[model samples]
Target: MNASRTPLFCDTVLAERIERAEARLMAECCEAAQRGDSPGFVHVLAGGVASFAEDGSPYNKVAGLGFHGVPSAADLDDVEKAFAAHGAVVQVELAHLADPAIGVLLTERGYRLESFENVLGLALDGEYEPVALPGFVIRRSGDDEFEQWLEVVADGAAHPDTQGLPWHEEFPREIYLRAQRHSAAAGEQHYVAVRDGAFVGGAGLRVSEGIAQFAGAATAPAHRRRGVQSALLAARLADARAAGCDVAVITTQPGSKSQQNAQRQGFDLLYTRAVLVKQP
Candidate 1:
């Protein structure tokens, strides 16, 4: 029997680039929230907004009640009520300066803490080193190659913990399909990593306003532990530089492997955010 090859992980610099890409996304989400645009924020949350808060969504799953801003103690009741009415989850973000007591209040009221994350960023002008993985091939993904990309996402989804909180079962399918459409419309680059003509992993790079955000990075189950992710990231960063981005940003859970992954690639934590989950 052939021995299983060990999956490769990213080094410090690539991790930093991933975190930098996350930062750009967080800023966009925060900006949408500040504008009181529920639909806009959800789209950002969905990786990109295709349709705005379409009516009759089960669980207001689309709106993600109270995600826009902090709700007052009294307002929390109303927000919870609204969430219950829609059979959905209500989330609130407390910044570093927010009182720690808020968690106690939520727990006392039956709301559980869902997750925490450290948002990281790197100036577009910051220096980043490129690492070469000679055997793997990375290149732009075209319309014909999209199904292979989807397969990696679907395979990764088998692990719920690794799949990320499922916003919608159809969300990923829609996002992947629509992203290609949008990128084609906008003339952006979507990339895939192949080893001997077989897809190993992929990432999306969109440059807007001089910043590049990395989205939809995934490696196949058989390809995990190999340097696929690291190689894909390095390729993306070089692409970001070639496109003239001034900075990169990404958001990640503080203690999760993703965080460690970002640090392994050299990302510095820019800030931390708490997403408070309450029972509806």
Candidate 2:
């Protein structure tokens, strides 16, 4: 894992690019939540934005703040109070480009580091090798099978390895469906892996500003190690490339199978962000 101080991770231009991408992604999520009436609200913060959902899901948190610089102590206080007002935990995703002092400041203010997530990126300038998985077909999901796709994704989310992660087990069926609907409404593409006419895995691709974000990827437990995810990934990448995306990015827990898979597919380690949380 590349730490924040690594030269490659600290490149000013790359950091700024990543910061903008993250901000755009978070803003999209906030918009999706609002559009779907998913019991959440988004608010602009000093250096970024804050999202809060009534369910206390950790997905509802401040992100993209302090990317250019550390926010003032007063601003942080205000953000915290806003989260508290919503009866939610005070969470923040601190990027490598963020002022290093923010970490110490958060810790001093009763926030604890929860996890490290690796942001991986792959350039789409080259031809991607086709993935052939016998007996399984991957394609863009249609509206008729939305529920099945959701079921497969939800089942995948329940895997032991994913338990306790924010937005993993916390999303109820309705909430998950709402999120997917929002993504579709926002022009994001959804893909599903099918075997013998049964949905086995799924993924989503969101293209914005020439960047394709590969997200919400999961494989049913029964289909693990069967190349379902790889096929899904290939399908999404091809679609994104066709859509004129020059870059593709995804976030995964450091050292997890997902991260390993991404690395194997030519994705370079960009930087790891720390998830910080403060209990109400």
TM-score of each: 0.59, 0.86
lDDT of 2 by residue, 48-117 (tens): 7777644634347778766556677887777777777767788788786577887888889999988767
Q: Which segments of candidate 2 are over 4 A away from where they belong?
A: 1-10, 36-39, 160-175
Of candidate 1, the 10-residue stretch with the lowest lDDT total is 46-55
- Those runs of model 1 whose alpha carbons end farther than 4 Å from true positions after fitting are 1-85, 97-112, 126-130, 160-189
**Best candidate according to TM-score:** 2
**195 Cα displacement, candidate 1 (Å):** 1.5
* Candidate 2 TM-score to native: 0.86
lDDT (Cα atoms) of all candidates against the true structure: 0.51, 0.73
Compose the digit string of candidate 1's lDDT tens values, residues 117-198.
Answer: 5655445454444566677777778778667775664455444235334332234444445333433344445677778877
lDDT of 2 at 136: 92
